[model samples]
Target: MEQNLSLEQIQNFKGKYPRQLWYLFFSEMWERFCFYGMRGMLVVFMVGQLGMNDRIANLQYGATQAWVYAFTFIGGLFADKILGLRKSLFWGGILMIIGSVILSIDPKNFFFIGIGFTIVGTGFFKPNISSMVGQLYQDGDPRRDAGFSFFYMGVNLGALIGGYICIAVAEGSMWQSLVPEHLRWNVGFGFAAIVMIISLLTFTQTQKKLGTIGISPLLEIESSKRKRMETLTYVGSLLIIPVIIVMVANTVYTDYFMMFIGPASILYLLYEMKNFSAAENKKLFAALIFIIFSIFFWAFFEQSGGSLSLFAVNNLNNTILGVKLSPNGVNNSANSFFVIGFAALVGLVWLWMAKRKIEPNTVIKFGLAFLFLAAGFWIFYYTKFFAGADGRTSLGLFTFGWFIITFGELCLSPIGMSAMTKLSPLKTQAVIMGMWFLASAYGQYFAGLLGANIAEASEHATNLEKLNVYADGYKQLGIYALIAGVILILISPLVKKLMQEVK
Candidate 1:
């Protein structure tokens, strides 16, 4: 399966990869700018401005994050059949822009509405864009992994810039002269909306370079039928937005929603298994196993946005060498900074190992991811020993912990994205990609459960008590991650065999 490129097309780029990759790269970068910008401040805003208890805020954050990914399955279904990737991305961007504007209005009731819109919009946009990236390369292209790595770097680049900028805006540090302190968070949300518009424009202008890759729907329909379907989609989306807003505001309902959808989704995948050839079935099963493991990895890893953000604010020292930093925002950027710094190096290492025929398989790479995640948590757990009289630990330690987890992310996230495209049957590619994110949804839900404990424990009067609670939680998480990593490594060979020659 060669790329859809003629000799002239091949010669035009004069680069190792297609020219479209750059366009996708920039498009994704701006989309991520909108996403991570708000994400960097979400929990903080909920706790500080909205005056929510930490437990409620954590639950809401977790539910919001979960729905954001969970809804991707629906988005992927629409793209795989009715909407096509291009239209999905376009509409998703429009919805997100609107959501960001709504979020800027007020953090009370409007927050849930804003989150609801963004969740659905991200569902439509995120997975389809990634699937388009996969379509740019041929099956078994060695550059495929490297291409995704480069794409992942763009994601992190957006995170790095947006994280800092949003924090500055929210804190009124950047535009203090123009914006009042009370309205700074609104300014940050507005910034996100503005960047999302840029992302939509970039994709709209440059998507033609994709050469029909994501331009048409997978299932052809009559023009009249297509219009009807599009109308239904719009109506359905509008109706569901309020439902999601309700779920996010209610933890029990959110839990029930996840419980119902999680197993139902797996059963749906199982029911579709009969559609594939034997070999494809085996590969899909392997992908499913990896996806399940990914849920575990993400459950712990995703604490960065919830408990970890709170940890930075309430527990870590924000002063570094006499410079006061915004701990939550700066800490959020740490993982992205590490990714930007090391992604290319890691890609080179993987390529070098491949040349020597010693590259680890995808399953083993996933195992390594769990191991790194375990180590990262253990590092933070150990920081309990260094807690000062103020009950705060060194900011450097938390940053270093994030640095280690970035390595774990490099091993899992982009590699998982590549694996989904490689392993799924061609007919169901986008849905499978959505399943990958669905794993993250489960992880996010689990993160909320775990973070709620931290929030509950943080209610203790003494800093020592808070540190003890966090330490206890991390100690258990580290142990569980270590065991999971080891079990995955032990079974890697079997999973690899199931892959049936997919590396």
Candidate 2:
């Protein structure tokens, strides 16, 4: 496959995809195992183990997620010009392993340190690996979207496994014989670190399957120049560690940092826009529009880890068929389980639609995503009416809500990844991918802010009061999302024009 077949021959490849897809698939699976494992437990650990209030925990979690994504810009810059994707991924995986290990120690001061390292590590790893996936196919490859969906399935597969294992272990629902209850969170973190080591090993052993793809910097540089760039990256990374630690510890700093960085990043992207041709510029403008819309989508969608998790704990009856389950565990694993079960079907549907040239364009797909998101939230919001005397909704409702959200994710997330590669100039692929995730950074920060508000509003309130607060919030968000989806649909024709038929 690496021999660069013509489009016809490439389209005729086995399994309708390249062999390297599996290597990347498994590598990303394990990496996500490490990432989601820790993430599933973070807010819960803060609330339970560290005795933090929900407001504080939500803010910190938001800051951590925001910074983790924000650093992708720096990592993408390094990979595009200096380290290349392979080296960036390797170093990123190493740092993540280290961070997970630090979290396993469960020391107080080291909490932020661990989060800091993991954030920077993820910044380096996540965007580069995804960019590598895009590198596998030529421009206009018909198989690109399906391949990404299959790859996305791998991501959810890992998330499913990691979410269940990490949450079960943290809750002492599993491994009680070997892991003490008080130390279970540490064990969960350690398990994540072990999986990261496996991810690094898998990628290292199988990267040869990728041939020359992601093997070198996009632009050639002298050895001395490369060395200096690497040195600067190292120094800058080290310098930022303490700053991230400080920012995470202080909400004021975190807010100010995001406010400044958000505009600054957009300005830089605009400056880079001058380098593209007119057609490329139009596509980028469209990309930016989609990016902005995605921020809103993710802000609500990401509640799975924050408000939704809390809702499960506080207001959901977590019994399924008379068996008890961990609320957060179920919540964390729900969307992933649905994605794992349905992503192939979704992919096949896309392929079938594409055969007739009827597949939705990127913008329309994004609009569908918002519509689904609104529907999912509305599903949950209306459950307030079904609350029993105990003020608990059925576990089935939460599960169904996530199932719907998974459909929305299917429409937006992977398509957004593919779109970044297709829409941006080749020179700025990684940077634009980073910007795509930067939208996620903003979404995470907004989610944190929203979660904090909900926490504060519900403080010392009854279960009914909490339900009412959440219901009101979800209703407003749902209406907003529905309106956004409508707007996007109306504007999609124009956006497609700007895209210059890249799809």
Candidate 3:
């Protein structure tokens, strides 16, 4: 009886979750492993292998990550109009595997080449999977939140594993006897490719149970044109590889590219507004506010991949509570590890408050996220005080700062995803999700700039000089986050009005 169920019937299932959710969960988990693993390695490899200066490495990291995210908007649009979710995801996975393979074969030489494929690939894979998960539940289903939360845990689980191991291998902390120092990077990147293959296979094998959930929207179109459209998407994505590589290698081009895309995206969204009613438009505007704020949030938070990763390499001690560990791995994985530990407990705290009629609304929750972010960055800056004469600091305190930052993430990110879906009209869900990710693109771009400036500020070769400069930069970010949080809280009423009954 269940085998023949349509998308609607699947959504109507009488369980805490439809069985397909676990498949999607595992698929996304492996994809995230590929992604965060690459992220944790990028700047480190640039400095350690390619012989790039700190400033250049930061900018390149920013540009590479920015493009990776910016393409999600394009990927989302292509999925909505032509390929649909399933095809987009499969194609994206293939591209990512290709990218990782390229790097594994020769990471130092083909770094930008590999990253270009990854940028395009991630766009197609990231947003659509989340949308498919949403499709598994009918609107207003009480289980929807739990299902999404379950999926969120999958994301972190992959990040935790990949974050730890991939960089560990790259840094020669794992299988030190097997992986030579020079080839460690090759194996590290290879791990991403290997897991992405797993992610794709998981999706292919399990997606049967999803029924018509993610089918291409063009079945009604004539066959020839549909084939042509699919061909064009693949070719176009491939052709853009060199362009992305150029932009990433030369940071100035990234600025030009973003200047074009950022405003163009706003205009396009405004054009999209014609289809939505006034109230729906207001809710979208509110969602936009959140997206805009999120850019700032991510800019600071993403230091983990750029500046903090470098910080971990240079400044921190090599142990957490007496067990020897890789500081870079800790830097990369600590937040993800904390998210795994605390995500459910934090959700329960919010639920408990809601049941008592005292829960913070989404807007306030967003504000609290910034406040927590501010506190976390402040703690990061305070690490300078804990540093030894050699400028090395306590790994335990550094990881503790991530604990507070995790709270901020718990407050905003999941809630923001929920709000984006709830507030947008049915027709625009994928586009809005794309926009949410695009905002992350902007954040990543700026984070690179921020990290570069900090890197540039320290001319001396001393570890102490680098520590003070980076710590001071973090202090400034903390102050900015503090102001943003306070302002968001102050203006909550207006955003609440825009949200209407969304909470």
Candidate 4:
């Protein structure tokens, strides 16, 4: 007689998590440390050190972020089908190390060179690590969402350290007597490189514990057909480089990325739709809707790195505990701090509500995210009327605004990952996860466009004047967010029905 699985066994089942996940987690953590640490400094460095205008710095930052998120989808695809997660991850670490070293060189044109390598490295690293987390669990595993939560915590942990700790070290004065000015920033990059090396070493040492996970793809497929297909795809993709270059160059005239990703995403969805049952179809629809709305939320929220960063610099006083702070880095830290502190709270609330059978569904969480986001920006706008002669606003106001935005991110970001893992059927799990990430990529792109818009009018404006312009833009975004939030709240009940109690 065949054995049937019982509820107790299913609920209590422990997936084998060896040392590998920890290694990957730490590796990812350090990589983020490098990425966010650099990011925190980039705006300040560009404007302060390089004498670049606010508009240029904002544009550059947005473009870099857009490429980073966009490549997550590419990384996911290659890992799932070609290089396998392990090799891709290892190579990614190597590339990032190279990038960091190049950045440390601090050449006149080091920005472009370092960013180029970082983008390439991120393309190999980002998606594969997330996929490996899923690989740790089995099909129909309820724990999958929880596992991703654990993984995302690792991401936030790195961000927390990078945003505050690393930045503090690089820019801090406690060690200033011991370190020279020219070498200070270089020390930061060096530290990042060392961390990458440590992560790479850690992963290699823990390989045996990982079991057969993240192995190379060559082991699975036959040599002949797979080789031909890989070569063809690579060549075809390369051949389209000129076309992509032209599109990127014309980003102003056309929403080239959306024109491509939107139709492509729709086609892919339709193809996948046929394979799903009615219940699964409903879940997919719900996810799709959430993804669209989430993009709008992110476009506004992501200003933290662009307009908000600038605001913290030009418009807000940065003195804290008698130590002068970098405006850009200090405000960015708020989001990460909230993620670390509130992730557990959010998780607990979900569990507590689930037990009472009164948990607001995923859609509700997203709607609330929009409300918080809009409220934060509106609060930011309120501070503008009190601007000082130097155009500096109260630091307390910026802090309070960041606190509100943190709650918004906590609701939307972690929950989106949870919903994606839960609602996706087993066979298409990785693809769906990739698509989830793809939406984020689109959001990052839109964020760039938005930042570019605010900065454009202020091209010749002083930093303070440009900040006022950005604040006005924030007020408008606040209105847009409010409208979007209400719409989501109205349809949330219907979306909740489609969820089928996956939570």
Candidate 5:
């Protein structure tokens, strides 16, 4: 029999980590498998099967991902106010399963419709789980960063497996004997749905360990009124599905939506700030600085899913160490692989540095992340110098670049998740985490525009021409990322001052 674990008891855990993190870790792992599976398939499917141009596919990928993260704000709000973390996650998982199943039915025809479901579902699913992870540790727990690091591993582990398998399945690299070439797209999508069900079930069986941590925020409300509020939220969520379909299908609508959401979120945050102390507000502002800079960070780093995917298709040889492999699969899964390998070691490095009292603060870590990001992009640019006559570059160098960026990602992303929880007021933690992802939404939006501009090689352009064009863009991005790192380091004192004792 299961019991309701109190928040106090969960947070009272003073060990290296609480056992609950494992359950959340596994549940989140499966959820990410579903997510990355779909993500790995998206732009590739659009280009190869849907007959879309690189620019259009990039724009569509951006819109789709932007909507996915943007809705996290809405989902976080709902979970904070009504459904609570667990329910929001459960509802979101159901929607994602539905979306993947829909895509499996007829990938090209139902692509946008399926994506619409996924965007809204991910909105509901993404932020709340991170918030719950935050709840496991008491404020000022030294282990919080490592806990998040372990959780981050779950995310990448899923990405590594699904990222490869889903793309391989869709492209007939796997299941070739069973799934016909044309129908592989369907199986690829269907595979995501099957795993999503497992994700939801994993949470269902283990969520009791979370106890009251993710329970409804309306526990104090009258029962009937709570029911009414919950009902309205469910109905409202259903209604947004079609609207999302429309927005995701048209890049122009995506532009409009992004323009509106950013200001609206800021205004809402301003409104919410009235409820907190001056000190908390300062911390919030500090989190805002990180959030603001993160948009640019992602703009450069997120090329993996957008332009880089297409680049892999057009410009890279397909093999690793003379073993036959897919460049696209390598592009899709490489960062996740590196992160999985490095996340824990990186986390432990922080612990060791802290013990020696030589730890770089979060802001410095972020700055260093950008420096590595710059180096990775520069390497990406340099790869073109070694291209063959057919214009394919060294797969070894491309993968090595991802290895460098993985350090950047390790420095920033898991740390950013930790920073949001630390900086935010307890009541608004979900909102802040949502804001963090919303920054990624903007990053994805601009990543699309940047990728589209870089993919200017004409249909008749030679492979070498295409490689040169993309490499030039990457060189520019490298310079920008390097500049961003320097500026962040210069400004770190101010942000660190605001963060005060949080780090």
Candidate 6:
């Protein structure tokens, strides 16, 4: 039987007030404001401003995103063990703000610097804040999932707003007259930087209130040996990065980042062995399994920003509500649109299930996520029916596909985060979370590889042939995803058993 938490525990779990959550909400909102805004524009900038092929641009874009998530694991570790959550959050936010400013300069050097800073900032900010959300609820608190669901909604809300707003500012009609084509990229990044500052300020104001509720997880640790090993791992990874860059110079492959992932994985494995226990090891192994599957999920889903974005620009009819829409505006907004509309509903569904003792286990949901995503891609694949006379596709078909993809994301992303927190023991949470992002990094790399194949093939193929390639790939991916989902479902009962009441 489940033990009901005491009233004191309930009050304690509220963590200062609902307002504190709101403060974090807005802070995250702005951070995502920068992230999604930049993301919406990144591929477009790569292809248009830099004059790279779609294949090269998508590959680079995927690498950047992979690094963003991969580094978050490292950042999460720093916050967990060294910097403490608040300081880490502050430093990360500040660095991100600075990165945003530099990116607004729109220099080629600034691109590298922006990626670096954004990576550092995400490292410091992402997991710590996510951890804080869990801290808001006491052990065995029933409301923990509900609270995370609420918080996850904030994430989608931010993504939704940032997606549309950034596209509007970046792709506006006024830009033709008010700004030069080359310099216009700065406008979106500048806005993102300003919003990031506001987010930082919001967090600063709420620190005292939040401080009373939960202490930093790093406070009680006294293991210098663990610290030393972590330092060594990071330094080693840093030293090897140049070698990887050199290799990238020589390789014919588009994904230069995979070389980095190889070395980074080695460093991480060595680090995990230091002072780690058997249970933690099991959890890490399981987490790695989930991470592996997530790569396929994200690779396909992320095409929305790259291949899909370009597809929308080139192929989709963008007339909506009797107003001519920018292709960027339509394409970039799809995930955000579904996220904003359905996030709350998905949360409510989970809450209702939890109430009835029927919430699907995380692994099972992961399977469902894969199938749903595959189904969405299948929708696009079959929608050859909607391809227009001018070789365009219906905006409606793409919209429906995005909705299905978002449903898949809803099943995976938040639930995955929650699993990362709950399944792992206290000591390795950040590194494990980093591993989660690493999977995404790999997925992004794969997405880039796939996009490159599409782009390269397009050079030889007619438009109809190109569309057929996309359709065929989509169909294959759909079948692959269906198999993954079915396998996960078959394994679900056992995976749930492995979780051992972690739900």
* Candidate 6 local lDDT, 350-427, one digit each (tens): 878888999887898899999899889898787666776666667777678878988898899877877776766666
Task: Record all residue pairs in model 6 with backbone atoms less than 3 Å apart, i.e. clashing.
Answer: 66-441, 73-434, 75-123
lDDT of 3 by residue, 1-503 (tens): 55567988888777566888899999999999999999999999999888988988999999999999999989988998899899999999999999999999999789889999999999999889988887887765545555666678789999999998999999998889998887899999999999999999999987778898878889999999999999999999999999889888888999999999878887888999998899989999999999999999999999999999999999999987799999999999999898888876776676667668787888899999999999999999999998987989999999999999998988888778777778787667778888889999999999999999998997565998789999999999999999999999999999999999777
Tens-place lDDT digits, model 5, residues 12-73: 87567888999989888888998988888888988889899888899888888888888998
Candidate 2 residue-wise lDDT, 1-503, digit = tens: 54454434533456667877888899899999988888888888888877999888888788888888888877897888778888889989988998999998973557888998898899999999999888778888767888899899999999999988998898787778989877888889888899999999999998866766776573466878877877787678767888888887787887888888778878988899887788889999988998999999988987778887788778888787788887788998989999999888888898899999999899999999999999999988988987887778878877888889899999999999999999988778998999899889889899998888988888888898888888778888889889989999999989999998787
Give all TM-scores, in the order shown. 0.95, 0.95, 0.97, 0.85, 0.98, 0.86
- lDDT for each residue of candidate 4 in 1-503, tens digit (9 for 90 to 100): 10233323323445523234576678777777777777776766667677877776776666666666665666666666676677777767787788788877882357556666666677667767676666665555544544555566777788877776555556653267776877777776666777777767876776545555666566657888777765664455344434433443344422556567656865777797899899998888887887788778878877877767767766887765566766556676777777777766666676667668787777778889889999998888887776777778767677778789888877787678767757777455556666776777677677767877887876777756866887898899999998998999899778888887665
Q: What residue runs in model 3 are displaced by over 4 Å at the alpha carbon?
A: 1-3
* Overall lDDT per candidate, in order of appearance: 0.86, 0.85, 0.89, 0.70, 0.90, 0.71
Q: Give the residue spans of candidate 1 off by over 4 A.
A: 1-16, 172-178
lDDT for 194 in candidate 5 is: 90
TM-score head-to-head 1 vs 4, winner: 1
Off by over 4 Å in 2: 1-15, 107-109
How does candidate 3 score on lDDT? 0.89
Candidates 1 and 5 compared: the better one by lDDT is 5
Clashes of 3: 0
Write candidate 1's Cα lDDT for 1-503 as tens digits. 13455434533444446778889889999999999998888888889888988888888889889999998988988888788889988989999999999988885568888988999999999999999888877777777787788899999999898987897679765667888988898889988999999999999998766766776573466888888897888789879998888888787898898989878878888888888889999999999998999999989988888888887777888776778777887777889999999987888788888889899999889989989998999888987888888879887887788899899999999999999999998668899999999999999999988998887977855877787688778878989999998999999889999998899
The TM-score leader among the candidates is 5
Worst 10 residues of 2 by lDDT: 3-12
